[model samples]
Target chain A: MNELLERGPEIPAGTWDHDWISSVVAKAEEYSGRPSHWNGKLYEQPGDVAGVCLPDGSMTISRKHVLDQARPAYTPGETLTSDQQFAAAEATRMAVFQARHSMSEVGDDSLPGATPLESLEDIALENARCDQFSREYSGRIAESMTDQSLPLVAQAPLFPAYSAATDRLLYTLGGPTGLSHRRLGELIDSTERTQRLNAIADEALDHEVGELVPESHRAELREHLTGPLRRGLGGLTMTEMSELTHPGSKHSWGWDSAEWTEVEFSTNLGDIKAHYESWEAEHPGEEPPELPDSLRETFRDREEEIQQVWASKGWPAQQPVVGREQAYYERLPDHGPVTARDQEIAKLQQFLWSHTAPSQHTDSAVDTGGRPDNVRQIGSARKHGRGVE
Target chain B: MDAYREVQRLYAEAMMSAASGDELVAELGETVQRIGDLLPQTAPGERASVLLMNSSLAERLARLPKETR
Candidate 1:
């Protein structure tokens, strides 16, 4: 059973002891012989629920309404009413035994906005919490109907793991075998990740160069590169910007056409900035490290000149993700196994994806200082997978 | 304090993701397939791993509002 969904959102863990349990157990004896209002069963068997403790020290088991909605139609191999449903299905039931233990703290109704202890004792208590749970359960059902509980890849994008990789790559970029300092070109993808990135990178670069933002306005771009985003994105250059902003590009891919969902198009600069701000809030105090002169040039004087040259040049939109993945894997025999050097980066990628942040080129938004447009939906060519950078 | 929690965490870890790096990677692949089968079902909005993976992401999620965030 997925405890997360079963419990609604996660509640922070807390302290509870046997002595406390014993006191509750004693109070709960009152319900041993009684039948719950909903179920005909006696309340002798109390469930092992982590009760929400009130300030007065009495513990309360958070109640969830037992509804068919909370049960997903397909749970690996069964339905709701089956004897085989997860034991956590007990979660929907009013665990009356535990309620009795929690009922004692409310001697008088002085706690403002708090429910009375007597009401807490009753298995049939109804109020806002219960109503909220009902709504949440319905939303859960609707969500399941839409987002199949998982993605094919559980891995994260490049990160602190990729940080070491990015740094080494940066060191070598002046030489060969690295992503060209020039905006290397084209975008193609039947999948969301690759297409989104290429579109973001190319679009943002073009958008920045086209619109003439004055020098002072470009300071943020320099700083943005060195921020927490730099952990995966590396230094601030048009090349680094495009590559780092390629959020989903680091992921593995599936080649056959039928399996992919083509996501096409782009939005303006303001929307892109909003996306960056949201992700930035996700990482506090993680400003990027000081830029070496090479990388910092994007942040320095003549920002206009740099943006202009890249904007004027051509950039590849992107290509197939599978071929890319295969290329990276092919290098494994010669370059060693496929492990990321910095685990923090792997963790960061997973964090971004799980949060459903825009997986494409918004990392470029900070470059132009928040002025842009959506990706152009062109014919999908499809490309990207390991070792392309 | 750290040692106690570490012991508790490791015990749970042993039962959770596989102990060996290769085993864990293999498990991730299998998990991905299983999740893929769930196609169209939204996993929880937040990955529980964020909470487990050092508190940085978790703290961020906590600080943000459910909607505006």
Candidate 2:
């Protein structure tokens, strides 16, 4: 069974105002034990349903008296005794009464001192206006509905800002080939990290970008991206960035489609880190390894820009390695002849580095803006190989 | 309910006709579809008022057994 079906469908909490609908659905689900369906069309939303299917595959409407004339109808599926039907009906009736009573108490009185008939007319007028509004803003309404369940990081008015901030940081540090893990550690101290984030947030607020990242949502977007969502970004790499930007590519990571929780992403990166650490111990060398045949094939498959990225990043011009298990090459680096272990290590460190704020304890020589002799061993991308500036 | 279905069919036909590049026809179709969507909320009878008054009741009744109603 679909997990959403198991619990019954719901308008995600904090996003919708239709609690009455949720309660009614819950009550119906209680007696039915599962959602109503017709020929496999799941009746997830009450508004979409016309009637319920009986065990014998027939349909039925609701009773009068139980549901007074003013109230809408429900169509519970299969084997609902009159009593169960009554119970469901009674629940709906009570829910309606409560919702109406609450609204009368708190709802805006657009026409003060208006008689009951006038109020009804006003409601009809409002309904028409709302229908017109829906027609005008149908696309936005649909986008909003689709986006409601998504995390703030993944949703609009935030995703673009998040993407822009990340790209800016990466570009500021280095070009296509980002800073090596060791160099990244030295450049961004805790204070600088804090300042950079604050600046990004401020920039987002100051700039009046229309729908790309709305001004109204920018403040909240900044708070979230700089807060919980910030750490999740640590796991991103050049390959991941490529995937994020080219959402339609075959290599596309389907993070947007699914509920990608921060814990799951961090745990995934942690597992990769642990595996790469073990591999690093076994294969301990800085020089780019012999080119893997799969990497060469992947190079061919990529566009001209990616090919240039590979060529400039010190990949061997010829003599590619072959006959290895394809699975072994699955984690191979996008550029350079570096072993999968090296790329994995860099990816893991990148995630960790992004997650952490500047360290309080720093190497005096490294922090003094002076490069240590050992730092030369693990050099920056530009220093390691001749590449396009 | 039968009227609602008829309206829906008419609305769908209007939409299909409008797709053939007539602006006035397209507008007419859009109006028809909007009326069809709002039928359950605005029909003259009490049953039509169900979703507009209490959406939950509409949802529940839509899924419940006929129970000889």
Candidate 3:
């Protein structure tokens, strides 16, 4: 383990799986030892031959490479009983889940596509690689340095740009560097994350009460959810979005503390509606019974149970709502107040009007000071020295 | 509205109502010669503005959003 994985989120109490952690760390360390050129390619296994470099400059690892690696045999810990081991295994599973959840938060969709254990291993690999790259880069800088500034660091591993000299020259000229690799990468990453988070938040909300929506209205409802509803949720962090949509979340309050309550009530109503709708679907011609007070009371009791969970969890019963409302409306860094698309639409809309409007052909004299004072004076007797009209 | 005016109205409505470039394309059906098809033949003077309109629309449509995973 590299510093990054060592500094990763701590395992919750009693959930630590030492063997699982060791395996992940070993895999990552092994990965880090491999040549940087083999970063994404499959490694040579026991039966595999050396990778052959082809004419077009791509290396073929194996023609008959298996899609998944064989799992190693597990060695149980001596001190722990089966039950304790099971608990540890469960904890390991949750850790992997948390890793996948983190990938989703960062909008690294490809990372989550792999098997759960592979996902954890991949994260470990990423952290190890980052650590390795930074160390190698630091060494390169030390080796190449003659002056205070690093003019030769472009040749270093993961420097992002190839022209450190150009950057240095521009810096000396007191001008901004034309190359903006880090900033551009950050911008692109943040934009992707925003869009993914928006979609996830929208889908979570839909799942929360989607049963209530009529089948006929499903398509329209989808559009609304993905469009304006997604836009509304775009400001929230993924965790906040998750809490808002999750029925069992104790601290569901986002910027608005009461929003969770509203969602909870609506969810209860949605359940009742869903039950009635299901019954109606079952018996096509029968008139459904009026919703009972008992059902409402039952859900209301469930709501109280949720409140008790909140209390037991030691979360504040009510969140501080006043200060955060304005913060809720603040746009994500990637999504500005006004976008290039909006400006384009406004421009094109104006162009459409300008071309189509009949009045546009005959220039309005408004810009020419509304047909000159002399022309206006000609209509009145003022030019001929008449006293008043 | 006249056919040409109606075309202009629909185009304007599409531009205004579209939340995205994809939506705009869907609203306005694929017309390769939009300028020739929609620009009023009678009004030669407005041809430049109509051309500008189509080109601007094309510029906007070209700004495709990055595909989400």
**Per-model TM-score versus the true fold:** 0.19, 0.17, 0.20
Candidate 3 lDDT for residue B35:
36
Please give, for residues A306-335, the per-residue lDDT of candidate 1 as tens digits.
222322322111111111111211122223
Say which prediction, candidate 1 or candidate 2, comes out ahead on TM-score.
1
lDDT of 2 at A238: 26
DockQ of 3: 0.01
DockQ, Cα level, model 2: 0.03
Q: In lDDT terms, which candidate is top?
A: 3
Better of 1 and 3 by TM-score: 3
lDDT of 3 at B56: 27
lDDT of model 2, residue A235: 20
Q: Write the per-residue lDDT of candidate 3 for residues A1-389, one digit (tens) a residue.
A: 11111112322223323323333323433323322121222222111211222112222221121111101112322354444333333222222221211222123344422112212112222222232233333323222221222222222211111112112211221211122434322222223332432332233334454444454543432332222112112112111212112212312322232233334434554554475577668976565554455554455344444444433332322211111111211212233455553343334324333333323333332225332121223134322422110
Per-candidate fnat, comma-separated: 0.00, 0.00, 0.00
Candidate 2 C-alpha lDDT tens digits along A240-346: 22211231320122132111223222232233233334445676543223323443332222322232233243221110111111122223345656765455444
Better of 2 and 3 by DockQ: 2
The TM-score of the first chain in every model comes to 0.17, 0.17, 0.21
